[model samples]
Structures are given as structure tokens and as C-alpha cells.
Target chain A: MRASLKSFTPLILFLGLVVLLAFGLKTDPRKVPSPLVGKPAPRFSLPALQDPNRTVSNADLAGKLSLVNVWASWCVSCRAEHAELMRLSREEEDLQILGLNWKDDVVAATRMLRVYGDPYRVSAFDPDNQVGIHWGVYGAPETFVVDFEGTIRYKHIGPIDRTVWEQDLLPLIQAIRKTTNGHE
Target chain B: MNTNPAAPLVSVICEIFNRILIPIAPLRAILLTALLAVSTASAYTLEAFAFEDPAQAAAFRELIEELRCLVCQNESLAGSQAELAQDLREEVYRRFRAGEGRDEIVDFLVARYGDFVLYDPPLKPSTYLLWFGPFLLITVSTFFLIRTLLHKRQSPDSALSPREHEQLRELLDPHGSDRDGRNGPDQDKSDRER
Candidate 1:
């Protein structure tokens, strides 16, 4: 037993080291939940693509139902998503679709607008992509639906489709609109 | 008009020769410095997929980090984060791009470096114990701990020595079986008490 106790201490410590290593390996970053919900819209300003003198700011979005779609010409999926944006702008009432062209060249973004026909109220060019990073725009063509009350209500990470609009988008707008009217 | 180019050349050569000699360690250091400078400018070329899709990039990261580097031992390609591990990860991505299945990738790795690469070694005849080693270790340890404790409680040799017995006797009685062997009067009393 005397000899056993001497060896057992090291053995127990070695086992502990194994457990520590297992815990260490599991310690990578987990998914982050978005904090944008219930908070006021993040203030931003960008140069309008078509008209350089006319800039769009968060203040411009006051008292309206609007969507801020982050897109770029270089992004392949943005081409696939052109028509849906036009359809939303055409069909929806009091729903303004604004474009945020992130990390794009002026010429390319302009060409994209010309090719696809601009669906936005006015597209803004964010050359340095600072705004995209702030919005957690990890990819091109992400959409955020901002309410008239200046709160970002919804986020779409990829291309928005009919299924997403029918299932997620339309319901969200109706609910927010209904709740706000009750206050009146 | 007394200008010989060789005369000036000889003086310059002498100055250079004076500065050129060094201890062996310093010479070795100079050589190593030159080697490092050469390598600094050497460009290493490699190809890796730059995914525009964040989902794909996330998936790629998961696969690279989780998968063990076959060429290296006992290191996850992600955790080691070595150049060889990076190369292996790039290879895995290439295979992923080619639409190779997971089994095909694993097979490729196992072919290159056998079971030593795997952290969770498979349970076959050869590695049956390796796969089950931890549980077996815990079981053996538990058995030994209980056995050691029980042995201490029950073993006859674990009892107090003769010297301890004498000390106990002295403690129990002030005059313990001494002085003219008359039992010290209290000796029998003490024994009876014990």
C-alpha cells in the first residue's frame, strides 16, 4: 500500500491532465445570438450609387417599413436574387427596399444596377465595407427588414426566396404593423 | 606619377584579411544568417479554395480542425495548425471539391499513414485494448484501490509492532510488569482493563 500510494498520485494527476485536454479541445467559439433584436437600428450613412450628392442615412428611414438588403456585384448569388428584390418593391405597400452594395467597385455596382434594373429606393455604395461588418454581413446579399420604429426586426443571411417571404417576411411585417396600430 | 594600382590593392586586401577571421561559433552563426536570409525571400506556392459561401467556409473549418493530420502523429490537423497539417487540410478540401465521400478521404489518409494517425483508434484485433484502454484502466485502478484498502484492514502484518505494543502497555500502566517482578500490582489490573 505504501508503494502503491506513491505511484497512484502521478497516475491520478495524469488522468486529470487527460480530462483537462478534452475540455480544452471543446473550447472553441459557439454560435453568437444576434443582439440587434429589440434594440434601435444601428445608425449608418453611405454615398448613393446613382446620385453621389444624395446620401442615405438611418434618419431617412424614419416612419416607414423598409428593408436594407446587402448585396455586391462580384457575388454570384446576387445575380440570382435580382428579380425577387424588384418584385418586393413593386408588390408591397409602404415597404421601401434599400440596397447596401458592400465591398464593391463603383463601376461594377453601377453595371449591376444597369443590368438588373435598380430595385431599391436608392442603392448605397460602401467601398470599405465598414457597415457590412457592423451588420454582421458575413456574405453578400444578406437582407435585414427594418421597422418604421427604427428597430431591425428580421435578418436574412442568404438569398431571399418566395418561400422565405411567404413564411417569414410577410408575417413579420403584419405583426409589427398590427402591434404599432394598437398603440394609437 | 608614382601610382601602382597593385600597391593600393595589396593594402585593401590586407585590411579585408584582418577582418575576415573569426571563431568557429561566429563563423557558423554567419553561415546560418545567410541561409535564413535566403529562405526569407523564397516563396512557397500552394493552392486552397477560397469559399465565397460562409456556410461552406464554416463546414470547411469544421472538417479541417476535426480531422487528424495523417502525416503527423497524435495531433488534430486543426489543433497542431502546422504547415503539414495545413497541407493536409488543403488536400482534404481538394477532395471535398472533387466530391469525394468521407470514406474515400479516410481511406486515403489510412493508406498514407496507418492507424497511428487516428486519435480514436478503431477496435480491431490488434487495437482492441487500445480502443478500450481507458475504461480498462479505470476498472483496474478501482479494483486495486478497494483491494489495497481491504488488505490494510484485514492483513495480519498491518497490526502494531512489538515496540508499539510495549509503548501502549507503558501508557496503560505507570509500572508495567517491572521492578522485582511483583506484577507492579497495577500490571494485572492494567491487563484486565485492556
Candidate 2:
């Protein structure tokens, strides 16, 4: 009996490892937690997408609740979320939506905005992706919710669908607004 | 089936051909193909960067491999063909050219993208499990294994009482013990007389 139990030890260890690996396999490795959450959003100044001569910066986004979306003309996922963004822009009057046009040609971005309907209050062109790097943008269509103090409150990695907007983002925004209004 | 002098030689040749050369032929082909694949796979174009010194260039290459491509997830910045990886490589290059050290560049990336941007995550409270979980499992397993081995070795020698030992002896040699018991004193007397 003792020998049998002793021999089963390896089998037990193997099973434990199998279980751990199975759990790991079920997880999506791309959904990495961002460090910028709860930290001050990186400051940047760039040429506006509409008019290259005009500039927009992070200073303009301060003292108001804002959603900064990083997107590019080449990104397919950005198109998927564009309609939702347009709807949100129309519905939510108090929330300011800013655009970081990541590594896109100005002409293409301008054309895309004109065709798709511009939801951004001001779209900043990041021709070299410098501002995108500062914002920790690895992929297009990443969105961040910034609070009144310019701190990044929440981040959404992929295309923001109706479910994600309703379940996660909407409640958080409401709660933040409540606290900020209470203080005021 | 031929009983000739040269038949054994012919059979030996056939055996060598069938058993050795036939099997090795496919294996050699596979090895050659694998070698070709590996050689072609490593044929990558050299990335152009103006470095102040060879050491800086080496550091730049090392840092690129150390950083993870967030978009690709599985590939390092050096190996990835993703646009984000290209941008990150450019960013690292620019930073290095501007006199930023390896640690400073890594810190800058970590600040923005978090430790996920690093291929090798630093040891901290949150990542302690990632770093040491396997060691912890090994230690626990080793403890249990040693305990079980020690118990198995010591149990037979120390666990039996004298009564239990007697019972075991009786069970093993019951007939031999009965004969010895009957002839014990007689055999001793006979041996003494001799």
C-alpha cells in the first residue's frame, strides 16, 4: 500500500501541472494589465488632424472628464468602434472625446474622418507615433478614460463594443462624475 | 535459402543495406531539410542604426530583444514584424542615440506600458509568484518525496514489535521450526558425544 502510494506521487504531480497548464491555456496573453491606470496621463502636443498648422495638447484636456482614443486610418478595428464613438459623442454632451491619430498619413486620416463622421472634438496627428508611445499605445483602437485631474482612470484595449461600454465604462464614468460633482 | 559460401556475405550486405542504410537514408534527408530550414530562417536583413560605439549598438540590440512587442504578444521587439514593434524599435533607437542608458529606456517603457512590455519581468510582490512559483512547488514536492522515502526505509526496520516479529517468523518457517523444536535437545546431546 505504501509503495503504491509512493509510486502515484509522480502521477499526482503530473496531474497538478496539467491542471495549471490548462488554466494558463484558457487565458488570453494579449490582455496585459496596463501600468498607466491611476497615473497621470503623459502630456503631448501635436498638430491637429484637420489643420496641420493648428496644434492640440494634453493641457486642453485637463479640468474635464475626457476619453482619449488612439486610432489610425489603417486600423480595421478602429472602424469597428467608430460608430459607437460617434453615438457616444452625440449622446454624452458633458464627456469630451479626443483623438490621437497614431502613425497615420494626415491625408488618409482626414479622408477617413470625413467619410466616417468625425467624433473627436480635436484630433491630434501623430505622424511618427511619438504621442502614441507616450500614451503606451501598442495597438490602434485603445481608449482611455481620463479624470478631471488628468489622471488615467481606466483603459480599454480593444474595440469598445456596446456591451463593454454599457457594463464597464458607463458605470465607472457615472461614479467618477458623482464624486467630482460632490466635491465641487 | 542458398547454402553457398558467398551467400552469408550477400545476406550480410543485404542486412546492412536494409537495416542500416534504408532507415538512415530518410533520417539524413530529414536532417538536411531541417538544416536548410534553420539556415534560411536565420537569414534576416541587418537593421541600420548609427551608433556612437560598438557597445552602444550591442546594448541597443540586447534591449530590443529584452522588450516584448505588445501587439504580437509572443514575439520580442527584435523578432516581430508588427508595426508597433517597428515603432518601438525606432523609439529605442532614438532613445539610445539621445544618450539614454538601457535601464532608463526600459524604465520609460515600463512606466507607460507596464512590466508586460518587458520580456523578462522584474521580481516584485505581484510577480513573485511568476518568478518563484515553480521553485516553491519543487520544494514542497521534494519535502513530501523525502518524507515518504524516509518513512518507507525506516518503517520495516522500526515498526515491528518483538511479538510481531515472532509471529512473522512463525508464519514464514512453521514446519522447519516444528522439526527443530522436536530435535533440539537430542541433537545437542548427539553433537556433544561426537
* Top candidate by TM-score: 2
Cα distance off (Å), candidate 1, residue A63: 0.6
Candidate 2 is graded, for docking, as: medium
Query: What's the CA error at residue A32 for candidate 1, in Å?
Result: 6.2
> lDDT tens string, model 2, A76-109?
9999999999999999988999999988988899
State the lDDT of candidate 2 residue by residue for B85-192, as single tens digits.
888888898889999989999999999889998878899999999999999989998998899799888776567889998878877874644554665566668879
Model 2 misplaced regions, further than 4 Å: A1-23, B1-47, B154-194
Error of 2 at A135 (Å): 0.7
Query: What does candidate 1's lDDT look like per residue over A1-184, in tens digits?
Result: 9989987988998999999899978853221224465567677888898889998889778998888888888888788888888898899968999899887888989988898788899887887655654564545677888888988897766778888788989999999889888977
Clashing pairs in 2: none
Candidate 1 per-residue lDDT, tens place, B90-146, comes to 667778777776668766555433444455567789877767878998999999899
TM-score of each: 0.43, 0.72
lDDT (C-alpha, whole model) for all candidates: 0.73, 0.88
